[model samples]
Target chain A: MPRATSRATLFEVAAQADVSVSTVSKVLNGRAGVSDETRARIEALLQDHRYQQRSGKRQAAPLLDVLCYEVDSPFGSEVLASIEQSARLQRIGMVLSGATEQATPYAHWVDDVLRRQPVGVVLIACKLSADDRQRLRSRNIPLVMVDPAGTPAPDVPSIGSADWNGGYQATRHLIDLGHTRIGIITGPADMMASTARLSGYRAALDSAGLTGEPELVRPGRFHHADGLEQGRALLSLPDPPTAIFASSDLYALGVYEAARTLGLSIPADLSVVGYDDLSIARWAGPPLTTVHVPLVAMAEQAVHLVMRLNDEPEMAFSRIDIDTTLVVRGSTAARNISK
Target chain B: MPRATSRATLFEVAAQADVSVSTVSKVLNGRAGVSDETRARIEALLQDHRYQQRSGKRQAAPLLDVLCYEVDSPFGSEVLASIEQSARLQRIGMVLSGATEQATPYAHWVDDVLRRQPVGVVLIACKLSADDRQRLRSRNIPLVMVDPAGTPAPDVPSIGSADWNGGYQATRHLIDLGHTRIGIITGPADMMASTARLSGYRAALDSAGLTGEPELVRPGRFHHADGLEQGRALLSLPDPPTAIFASSDLYALGVYEAARTLGLSIPADLSVVGYDDLSIARWAGPPLTTVHVPLVAMAEQAVHLVMRLNDEPEMAFSRIDIDTTLVVRGSTAARNISK
Candidate 1:
């Protein structure tokens, strides 16, 4: 039986090769300035010991670290899963640095990855500051940003779904259903999706002869509880709208709950619509009418962009916009004939 | 300006060191055959090239690859997210391999991982067979099984939630409420959780002086559509049970839908209960009365177990059972007063 050999040390290799550690590293990395004989001997020894060589230098596998901040949400979980799948297919291992967007800044996460000297990084729920982005550019580290917007970092690449189009389609669907007095529930003001969805809502109303009603529009964070509260608030208004378009499925589901609590039947009392047609949408009490965003496709695109950046550092920055569709379920009807 | 140094090559170093490729490798790895004088010369040369004498050998970071086989369920995404988070915290870079349990056998996945020589592997949705387990054990590759019930290799570690206990508690709650004619909608027969939950339901009934009714039991396969069909089937029986227990929240939600379709009211005409109180449960149409499984905690535990296995291979094998809680809502009520 060939007994497993104890792992070899760098010092032993350096001493036996009659060369300095730096010379061995340069030779292993395929860097210049070493004698041909020394490089050959090092290569032979590396092969004999089964040491992995990279860039002509013998070293272990390269590291690709990831930092996900504010990852406690369901969307964060989905994005993380997709990235993991993509990373695995690429055959690159990743290290996760802890930080949530709600609790930590991007600077702290970047510092952690820098300390580890990772070959590349994927940033989720993290927005790089101009200074941080500059520093990363200086270091020549490749980066791929997911769902970030309004950043003028011309060099960095980003991947995200087309929320603007999704929102537009969702809003337009309700309009086509002959709903003039439509209500809109949006995500936070700071988020790109929220603003884009709001824009879509406005565009839909504009396309029709209807004016946007400030009273009917409410903004909240992307959460089910937020949706519930907003739903209750909207329903309490003296002249409640004929139709409501929530920015997220969770919010729409909340509206369904609110309708139930108010003793009002869906489509009979109020028409409701939602976005992000999550897994639960199809099972929502009334089977929610919502926009279906291609989550898996977005994740795959993000990973592809990140990996592409790794090979061609100078590749032109690209943006991928996946399409969304409105899945009409039982939630919407011709503006309650009774109304 | 320091122009980016072109990567160094092995030939360049060997020629400069005036040693054969084999000699250089031996000296660098610090093998016994190399003379002390030759070793010193190699060490000096490596140092000049900026390579640190790492234990007399040059080494790089190790890679940890992960393959996520598609399981064709929404819950698979959530489980995958937990595994990714855990892997990231451990500083292990993961490579995701996508395989579905329905399409590929466990042995093929094991062979692929062995060939890649990842530091370790995390298999999702792939069920291990007796032969596959033996091969994994012989290779001595650390593996962490998620949601696994049994493994042929006793030494291999596994992690999952306490589904049997959860099921028992859920059924006992319904029995305590004086529901003697309780019905159950179970997941797929092959799933360990389904079997355990069925056993729990039977135990609850037995303890409550009620015999299990085969007519009231239905196989649902854990899908909302299936649950809907099963719900309709149960209600169509000559004499339907007063209360129904769905093995999963998604299925229970489907039951709620079925009730609506049949013009029956929940907790009045038919009391409904579900498991895995997912996020949508609370805000569900009826505020589902169901069992809550701590998904985040379970995820954290699985990751912790895998990381621990990496360091202390001999750590005594133990199962971590997470407690379940019953959240009462509008779905369950006192047995019909009219009856």
Candidate 2:
């Protein structure tokens, strides 16, 4: 039997069947075109010769497709690395697509990705919009969104650190330090994490016999430069809050820069805290007191979620919120004389 | 024409051609077993009706794949993000795959990614062995490596910051400041960056009429913890070099921590310079005097190099060397007379 030719190429199959390569591809893809008689013959030959193209095993080890949307932030790269790490562990091939938040339509790109039939997708979902979410849902592709909340898609799962819990704990810690008047420098209003953290801050304030002071709560676009501006604005208030909690470590670092410019010492004149606890937080002039999100754990969870979706196609939407820790550094202190 | 009927469905095509659904699919796909007459007829119909799949536009877009083997490092994320940003500007798709340095048969993953027919691949080439490089070269995939040098596959293109220039510039800056005796903290020996930096240090010493001192140079992994150990080791020497150049910013930070522990002041008892002026360098206590490698530029170049390969597949192997600058901050100075 000529040693049962180890593997059959598409060329060999097309030549043997006296068909064009396009026809073989169509039949293999289960697209409409071949006659019933021809399909039966191809199927019979495939079964007899054990020539299974698009086998479950092949699809199981399919390529990893990645789509990265530009977020104009320093942390975007970190998130991409985390997703890439997870994709590698699954032994999947990867394709990367780049899009901007404004110029590219994510839904169209996602639809294109799905046609390639990748094993799974890791979307750096920092800025996907509502319309994009609807498109993803319509396709029902298995996806794991990092850093941003998925738009309530049935098959798409999301994994991120517990930003709300982190925010709550950070705010509660400030309150526990005897600060009645606190301020917040939030991320963009449209961001889910920003909104969630704001809610947590409100919850903590309410629990501490304090009302939500609208004056103290200001929104910034979550850039270091914005943080600096917001910091200056907060300190300039008639009765500024004793402590400030910035949503991102970079923002908090900006606040530190602002404080430096104003000669207000951290943890002494004004207490400060930050989220994401990026590497810079530890080395900031007087190490920043911030919440440490479990990035590696989040990465692992994202990969697992995507892999599981392959088996449980109808799996319920899952959200994994990894726990965060408060690293008490030199940035925050007990309010000596609070308002 | 019923408003052009919103593109023909499979059912419509089958009905129009007086064929079963499977037969129509087969004929459209040009599979064998269909008589010549049927294939020609189906082709004519498809051409007339313009029944193309939805994925046509997607296939036309540029697709770039990346495989990242390490994600734990702080700089890793930043580089990946930069690449994505650069790729996005060109309207390219990037697939990211993460793998561990310890993984064997690295080429297998590369092959899997190549099967998708990506325009080219950018490998974060850390710790890949000669054998692995050989395997990757054997695949005939258009490849560009980042951060690793001296690849066995000479034909493959690479892009990285001028680690040698960074090191030499840092050492010479210290020398120009009238510091004759200089110490060095080197990164891991096996890393290309480490080696390049070491050569640069040697060149700087030779230029300053100072022979390389083995006693003054200590090998340390490029981490803060190792930097601490190496910093302590350098300080304990009978006659420590007045100025110290640590291969990485993390290592330089470690030196700061060590100096604090030993009651030594920066640029007073000890002068320190670092490489890869990471974000934390400016925020570090008494901001570090370091060599600034244009990380974003390097990443952009890597992406451009890979993308360019798609258009010029036979382009000669290219090596892009980005410039580095000496960011003089508070970390280095003239030798202290008391010391």
Assess chain B of each prediction and give its TM-score.
0.73, 0.75
lDDT of 2: 0.69
Lowest summed lDDT across 10 adjacent residues in model 2 chain A is found at A1-10
Q: Is the docking of candidate 2 incorrect, acceptable, medium or high quality?
A: incorrect
In candidate 1, how many Å is residue B230 off? 1.6
Q: What does each candidate score in C-alpha RMSD?
A: 13.3, 14.7
Model 2 Cα lDDT, one tens digit per residue, A196-252:
889989999988879978988888876777778899999989888889999889889
lDDT of each: 0.67, 0.69
lDDT accuracy of residue B291 in candidate 2: 91
Residues B94-184, candidate 2, lDDT per residue (tens digit)? 6666655442225445445434555667776453555334333323236777876333245667777788888899999988888888889
Worst 10 residues of 1 chain B by lDDT: B52-61
**Root mean square deviation (Cα) for candidate 1:** 13.3
Q: What local lDDT score does residue B126 receive in model 2, on the 0 to 100 scale?
A: 53
